[model samples]
Target: MKNYFYFLFFFLIPFGCDNTKGNKLVEKSTNDSSSIYLDKAQKKNIKQSEKLKYYKKSFSILKNQTNDSITRSKLFELTKELYKNNFSEDFLESANLLTTLSTKAKDSFYLAQIHRSKGNYYKNLPNYDSSFIHYTEAEKILKKIKNNDGLSLVLINRSLIQFDTGDYTGADKALNSAYLISKKNNEIASLYAISVMMGLTSMETKDFDKAIKYFNNGLEIIKNNNNLLGEFNKETCLNNIGLSYQKKEDYKKSIDFFKTALKNKSIKSEDPELYSLLIDNLGYSYLKTGNLDEALKLFLESLKIREELKYYNLIVLSKVHLSEYYRQIKDTSNAKKEITEALFIAKKKKTHRDYIAALKQASIIDVQNASTYSKEYIRLSDSIRNVEILSQEKFARIQLETDEIIKEKDILEDKNRSLLYTFIGVVFLLSMLFVVRAQRARTKELMFKQAQQRANEEIYNLLMAQQDVIDQSREIEKKKIARDLHDGILSRMFGARLNLDSINHLDDPESVKKRLEYLNELKEIEQDIREISHDLSREKQDLINNFVSITTNLFEEQTATHSAKLTYFMDSSIKWDLVKNNIKINVFRILQEGLQNINKYAKANTITVNFRKENNELHISIEDDGIGFDVSKKSKGIGMQNMISRAIDCNGKLDINSSKENGTKITLNIPLE
Candidate 1:
């Protein structure tokens, strides 16, 4: 939820190059001593073995050639093809040559393109720092040249890196910026890609409706294009949309989308990755929809392809899902084996998401065995979630540093301009003093008044700046605590779970029961760990939206506890993403205080939390059917002051309405963008 926007933006990058021709390249035998020629058969036969030789020759020729952007572009394309084929040496060499040629040609566009390609290479290598640098450089160049297409492309690429590196917020911003530019330029390919990304981000953030809308828009664009690859992308979007709906417990709609996505399989035989993904998604969908047989069959088919292709990551994911499926059908033995296998792979891969998933499956297995494995699963899940939280915080810190540098640069420039203007004014004043004494006196008085006003403004700005620094420090501390919880406590608990598992295998029944009880206690600890991890990772800004739900739940629980007739209504469909952590905490505290006030004074039997969004604004209404106070006559209390301050902190507004014999309604409106 913290980086929901970032997720949306990062998803758009692949679509930028969607217009490129399908994966078809010229091939030649490495051993064959034949002259290179551009022909249909030769182009169709391109192989990895010959890539280095061909790229080297092509790059050498292009380096010597002058006054030919078109030729240079073609050579760059060849280099990209080489890189795509995993010819690392050839790719780097060609990329370097292309960079030199583009620079000499003074072609900013091509330079940006070369940088983007280099960024892609580094990105695939998982060198996120280098990838981000290249992307930033390319963005600067594109912006300077006012090339919207180039800028959008760079933004998309940058977003991908951010998403991979856990900078979801940055990724979202980059993606949204690219989407606006693409829409303005009427770039269909970019638009479709952006749409897909938006859907993906929405799905990531658990906004099912938004995810569906984005996928639908992307499908519409792909349908209009009549492109096979676009269709493939559309299928992926549909699969994700279905998965999102499934997460929200909408089985009927999820099944519908999964079936629709499977309707196209023209290239499934040629693209194992695509085929495997589709099958796995379908299997998962079926599992969710209670179609055990269909789920098992699809999952098995997917596992086969994954094994053949040696896609270990996907294999781990599939195995865990299958384990869950088997467990649902009461096949405990098979479930245990599959889950154990998944755990081994997850440990080997050190992939946090996969590790957490495997642990979740293992926990289900523990339910049947009544063994310590459940504790182990919980421990591992907690550890993985903690690490994820730390990674997210690290990314946020890096972005903050980058932002600070830009702000400092702007301040320096402003100071320099002000100094230059002051110097010029002084010279003019001295030179014209005698000629316009009366006018000069008036000007001096005005300057005196302006200087006094400016001084006061500067003092006010300094105080605000100091407050901001303090807030930032607090945020950083919170992130540190979150990281510590994830890395230290969670990891130790997991280790404890492993120890408990060892105890469970002992022969003595007495020891086994003792170990099982210990494991159960650990399981509770693990649950607490997960809850804390999630809470820490959640951005403080999202508390505004979460408050409505939280308050509604509290009201319901209170009613049930007190045996009072209380009616509570909530929208339950409002979508929100946390923009910052500080905002989230403040909003949460404010809501807490409001609820406390209601419990003490409102004396209401019913409550309602209404949430709605209009463009860039968010609206929240909390009302209770209780004895209300007179707003005009009653003095403002500490709770009101706290709520007002919280609203001001987020640049939001709060309105409170109440009267004798009537319930109170507190409406909070916040700007989201």
Candidate 2:
């Protein structure tokens, strides 16, 4: 990743004199007078600001010169340069000509370079995945020709795209490879760039000491080279250093570095994005130091620039800082307003950090509001943290796979080297024979190991199968019990109520009084039957089919019994094929338990159930417009545990979002197939 950023930093800077200013630059001349004439025509056309005409003239010259790979390569380079300068239509025209010339001349290097150029163009558009595909295609040809430098550059660019897409580990590996290549080639500028990128990655991962070390190394290189552009990078490094210090609550040092970074005139002139970022960091530092007035001024200034540039991400950051400033000043009205606006922006931009930051600031306003906002802040924080962790894990897995491939390659090379030693071949063959005999002696032992592994797998499968059977049996048993209570007991109770009614109709005064007493008891029994029958019917049946329905029905019944309005929506399209019966039962039990909890603890009204399917996954969502309890401060009840366990059983995901005012949304997504 570091290498990737380094490449971008160097490549993005205009190389040589500014051609836009009509500066006359000397073209390199070769012994071929025809080539010189063609070059002069191209240069004259370019000077006239006619890129298409220049490319056409160059292509016409190159078609005749296709016998020379060098000429073809030059045309490819010129085409790439045109593309970089945004003459995309002319660039494609030149590229197509170069492709034809290269193929006719059988020039793999030129072909590879054209592909690399295409990748760069795509990358500039921020089409990372597409850029990666092109880069990989170029890499195949470059590797065939042993063009290490070209390969390294392509790898670095690919890594940059990966970094932008949040594949930090991939970026790191690519940078490391590029660094190795640059070191071998003794490319000082490239090396320095790679070091800066490494530092940035360290900063991203919150490894301040390592980040500082890398930044310092890069800064030393820049100082030695006297590269003004590299100095601009140093400003970024300083900004990151300040950020790391701020994260650690070392506000004084953070402020110092931030101020130093802001003083860099090169950074100000070269990159508006970096300048805005530095300003935002300065604002954050001020806010942390309790200088609300200074923070607000900087944040608003940054916000104005970000909004003008349509920089959605930085706009959110600025809004969050402004919100925090308002919060610290006890301006509840303004704080609430700014925080709400920040959240809206964050959501629109889909930036987790901004959302979390805004929520955190909002949570600091007042005790009542704080409770609600804090819960939201915590939930967003957890989700972002989880995403980062998962990304890291994926990177680790990729690294492991790469290592395995390298190890296998090494083993193959070792075998080939052994085969090359003709004298040792006989000896090695004899040794192999002996080893094979010894392996035969251990065949029984190997057989036993295999048998053991099979036994373990069989046991595991049996356990899973048994658990599924048990879940099915439990569901069936619950249905049977509910049916018996509703059908048998309720029917008998209804018959007894009828008999009591008939006795009450008789006209003997003494008998009538006893009959009336029996009639009153029968009325109580009938009420009990009605309540039990309702519980045994839809509620119990729903518990068998859908988890969300089970919970929703329970809440609705409670509302009806206790006079509360519980609204719910259950999407009928959710797939249940991949979900085990055990998981279904557990989910049902948890909902049953949760409803019971709301009935016992929550004092407010309106429960809601929302279920849907997205991305080939089923999401069972249960929410309530009731007084929500604190998730972090309070321990989970057995019911909640049951819900979690059921989610695990199905290899499903669960999220419980709740607070004091904002009710809970328990979402469970179980993957299908």
Candidate 3:
């Protein structure tokens, strides 16, 4: 399983190199001693020792030379090819030389490649600590260069190291990180590889459900990416999912999955190892479900392939399976023979799980050595468990050291952020202080405006009283004139007419004509005086209903004072006589304040004021077409506030709506009742 991820990394994320330029440089360097020896080492007839010597000579010559782009490229390719061909000794030597050359040339990309190659070399050597160290170095370089693809492949390799050491938790962490990178970068191969490894690790941890889920995720990935590689991986994913179900004792379901995997025609020819594994799994599932004949046939077939392939670990497993199949049939003799062969191969290959399986089968089948096999089995199980614990500790220590380095970096970043926040906090405090002082000054200005408004209101009230007095005086004068015209002048006219009528009774023709003319003239004078008296009486009634007139005068004054053209209308239905004095006074003041605000700040060309009575409520609206302000924002100015206060005093609601360049409208509604 580890080899699967390791080889996949090579296939999927090969080292990036400028092979064209490197080849051109090699052509140019054909006459150089290193190039000559390097070419000679590539010949098919060369001995293995001669080839190694020539390769060393080539590297030695280049190592002493001044490093350049051409030298770095050459060394990078040579080391990579050697690593791929499994020339461990020559690969390590050339990789070290390349590292030196790349470091001198400041070639981060090649440096990372060399470290990753060395990591694989150490991993193949089975030196996990050195492998981890080299991989960490490579990971750091890849992260610095922002090569997400390279980083993800490196993480997969690291997870393999952890997985081999029985650190399933650590392996899972690394694979999860690799999965995130592959998902983000859309690296399909890495996604498939990481998911499969994660499933294997979950299996090792005995989390069979999670293992099945991960295997299914791998299957989904392969299904979406339909290619030869995906089709090949599909069998493995199904095999793994089946194994997970088997671990949960669902043999029937697992047999179905195994049979489905076997349906792939190329699996036996192309991937015999996976084919053998699937058959073994299916045979075990069949054995669990009582199909002994089919189970024994599959066990023999898998053992034949595993032996043919010389896979000792798999051979040991196959023998153990056959041993179990023989024991299940109650053939104690054949079971002992198979178990003995399995134990010999398992011990030779150090295949612990196969060895344990064989030991347990031996104890079950051979009563004579049952106690001996059982004791050895117990000791070996404890030993493997202890070793697993130690490996887990080692992995935890490696992670702890890495975390300490990251924690130190985070601390430095936190300190920098703290300094930045402190500077921002200081600036915020200074701004707040300035704002507070400005607000205090604004408060004083508003207070002055409010005091001036009160004074103006007092002056307005005095003027209204004075106007009422003038109206009363005019009424008195008109009444006195009417009384004089009707009571004194009209009474005298009646008396004179009576005297004329008496004289007419004793008149001659000439005297009668002159008396008649004087009587007609006196009658005409009495009619004129009577009409004048009636006119004065009507004028007195006009003086009593003067509020409308006073309002009209105020509107006229606004038109005369401001540059803006003003228009106003007051509802005749208001019946001012019924309204309380306070309501009238506050309503008038509010209107006055509203108009004054428009004149002062509206900068409008047209202003309109309207008053209407609806449903026993008086409504006033003042509107201006001006550069409007946002009514949503709080204003420091007290003019609008004063108008609102007056409206509240009159038990009215005031609303102002304004938008930039749209206009402003102020409306107030007061209940008459």
Candidate 4:
């Protein structure tokens, strides 16, 4: 299975009193109005609607007081800030208003800032095309003006959009650029954001060590800037580090980080959302560490905070964890209550993360609900995958258009005939682009259908081949049994019978001695019969005839058929008879599939396959010293897909680790139970 990490970023702009001569009057008028009621305490405590009312009243007072372009631009800035704080549910309106104000002021700096804000707006909406377009415009002006801080922010935001759209490689590159610029400028805030994002991207690709490094680096930068936002991001950075440790299965370290995060005064006292998140994280860590009482206490506390804040999104998140905690303790009633509440919120809000968690919990405690929830989860998963696969290139094109539009508008504003020609050309090109894009989407759909058909055909062929392999295995076993009977036991019995017959033909005196010899021969024959019976008994599983032997045969064939130097090592402790036949076959099939993939793609000279039994799981690892490809890119081969399916069917977790160095290593862990 692939690890997909999702990140949520908070973009902050510093807001302080500008004590210039004209600003004094504007600031006084705004501050004297309802603005004091819209302070941090009121913002966090009151309803968003009430906060918006205060800000709206303040904006109305400021607008009436100012008609000068400079003052009006500042008013618009405050207005947008108000919207971001209290009315961000309608972000598009705020973004449009800012764009109009920035253009009127004829300030590129303001223009870049507004465009970036618009990008963040679209990103919150999860409309990638618009987000990328706005971000691209911001990047254009920031680069031209040589604003490294601004450019870093734009690139980091763009990288986030890229990651959401499944362009992992592109996402990494963008972050790298942002990191370089931020580091060069020694911009601690930008550096903090960029590093955290880099950590998220690494986590998405399951690079836990690198993720920990990046997250800790971000946390260190946060230490350098001990402001409000820095303190908030500090907790977030700590939580992310804990997540990395948790991914590495270092639950003790994870719990330590979670506990440390809870100690942040700003998070605990000021930010309810961050406080609840840290609480939930600590609960999970405690749960994993088997501190059930503490875990439940933390979860309940997190739930209380979220409910009080009326953050329904986080309420569901807390409930999901609560459900799992209850289920672990076999409290079905409470489990059902929590999961039911979570599912209701998910349905109401159309939040997929909550829905998926609810469904997964249903699979464990609610047997009747399992099939229904599982099917719905699968359907939603497919839709999400389709959206992710198709979104990036489309957004990339839109970003290119935003750049051209800005450039053309800059030049076209001064021209008449050239503007006319340019507009016509752009419209014509856009029409053609839409047509081409539509064609491409159609072709992609057709190709997908064709691939599905091909997969069905291949499955049928594999089923036919499976029969042949099974028959061959059975035939080989039968021949071995026959050869043992003919060459060992039966021959011994025949010779004993011949010696007994000779004893009967002896004279009186020699007959007694011959009879003793015949008795000894008869005893030997009886001992031989006992040995044959033991050999034929099913009570003791014979390694030569069992599932391990069958799988070993497959490995032998793989080694013989490939030029790669293949080595296989197995721990002697695994009891093959304890494993189900179907599981054994699935493991064998997955192994064969991996070998096939290596042969086709990994240009390697050596391969090593290792098997071990640890805890309650059987782990199989296959590594190749090959030129590895990016695992972020989805596999194109049917065989690799089949291997993934086989691993899942065997109740296993499969991890395919690959990069340019040390090659690829595929590991599968299946529960022995």
Residue 203's lDDT within candidate 3 is: 83
Show where candidate 4 strays beyond 4 Å.
Answer: 1-11, 14-110, 124-128, 163-168, 227-229, 400-673
lDDT of 3 at 11: 31
Cα misplacement distance, residue 141 of candidate 3 (Å): 2.7
lDDT tens digits, residues 1-673, model 3?
2322111212345454443322223324577787788788888887877877877787888778778866776677667666666678778888888888788778877788788887778887877766776787788777777766467888889988888878888888988888898899787888888988888888877898998998899889888885724446777788888888988999999999999989998889987888888898899999999999999999899889988999887777777778788888888788888888987887667667667777787788778768767876776677566666766775566555754534464564565467548645653564476468658867887789778877877776787678668877987998998998898999999899889988988659998998899899999999999888888888754444455666778788998888899888877677776677677778777777778878877799998989899999999899999988977785645666767778889888999898988889989999887
Most accurate candidate by lDDT: 3
Model 3: residues with Cα > 4 Å off, grouped in runs: 1-58, 103-107, 228-231, 402-673
- On lDDT, the stronger of 3 and 4 is 3
Report the C-alpha lDDT of model 4 over 1-673, residue by residue, as the tens digit. Answer: 1221222445444221233222223333334443454353254567766766666665555545543445444555564665457466443554565566657756566667677777777677776666677888888877776665567778888887887667777788888998898788776777777788888878888899998999988877777675734346777888888888988889999888878877767666777777777778778888988899999999899889878988777788778788889889989999888887887887677566566666677677767557656775676566556556555555555556765755565443345346447645653564476468657867787689658855754774576467558756865675577567767877777777777776676678877787877777777766776666556543234434355666788788877888999999988888775676667767877787788888988989999999899998999999999999888886656567777877888888889999876689999999988
RMSD of 1: 33.9
> What clash pairs does model 2 have?
1-171
lDDT of each candidate versus the true structure: 0.67, 0.66, 0.77, 0.71
Error of 3 at 510 (Å): 99
* Model 3 lDDT-worst window of ten: 1-10
Using lDDT as the measure, what is the rank order of every candidate, best first? 3, 4, 1, 2
Model 2 bad stretches (over 4 Å):
1-49, 60-71, 96-106, 228-231, 265-272, 308-310, 343-673
Q: All candidates: CA RMSD in angstroms?
A: 33.9, 21.2, 35.3, 21.5
Local distance difference test, candidate 3: 0.77
Candidates in order, TM-scores: namely 0.50, 0.49, 0.54, 0.49
Q: How do the residues 1-673 of candidate 1 rate in per-residue lDDT, one tens digit apiece?
A: 1221111212334213412222212333333222232122136566645655565666565566664555555666666566656788877887887788778878776677777888788877876655666677677776777666556777777776666555566778888998888888777767777777766666666777887888888778777774533336666667767777777888778778877877876736756676677677777878887888999999999899989988777888789888889888988889889987987786676554665567666766756433444554565556545544554564455445644534465564565467548644653563365237546756787678657745754664565457557756866887888888888998999999998898677889999888999999998998898788778667554444433554566666766665335554444344443335445455555666666778788777766666566666767677877889899999886458768977998899999999988888898887875
